[model samples]
Target: MSTSRLFSVLDKALPDEKIIQDFSDRIWNDKELNGTYVELNNEWKFIPDNAPLDIVTKALFKEYFEIPFGTYKVMVAIGGNYKSGTWIFDSKILFCNALS
Candidate 1:
């Protein structure tokens, strides 16, 4: 997807709730990460791996945000469609505070 469109979808998915917006902006502006959304089973899933958006977001949260290392699944709706993924975050408190 185009960079503008990606940020738009990310904003819709994650919203502009303080740190969440910071995190989303980081992902959108990071030069090293060339991530994209892919359609799977009629849903768009962002999987964390060595490549793509999921891994990039995971790494950013871990290193930049200093979130603990673990896995967490988060889902958000964009334009009546759902986007879900597994994110790496060890602390439930941190997750709740950061994303809630």
Candidate 2:
């Protein structure tokens, strides 16, 4: 009687290939914040794409947005608003007078 596991046999038959891991910082267009907004992990279930690969790819990169410094009531998630993450770049406005 043969008792070899199917996954084990598949692993042996498949060749390892280099996978390009390019992740964007912007959230994917889903109801849930699917980008850097959530804590990243390798344990994926009920999510699209391969769990391990998807987590690794998304977690590897980040995007920085240059937001003007001001109190902004920004919407984080759907109907979810927050004020803490707003950043103000006041230095640019302050230094512009010197250049003139």
How far does residue 14 in candidate 1 sit from its true spot (Å)? 0.3
Candidate 2 residue-wise lDDT, 1-100, digit = tens: 2435643553354312211122121223353533223332553323222223211111111226644532121111222123444652222101100000
lDDT tens readout by residue for model 1, 1-100 = 8988876866565444533444455334544545434455697654222222221131112245646542232332222222344643332111211232
Superposing all C-alpha atoms, what RMSD in Å does each candidate have to the true structure? 15.1, 22.5
Listed in order, each prediction's TM-score against the native is 0.21, 0.15
In order, candidate lDDTs are: 0.37, 0.25
- What is the number of residue pairs that collide in model 1? 1
Best by TM-score: 1
Who wins the lDDT comparison? Answer: 1
Candidate 2 residue 38 Cα shift, in angstroms, is 22
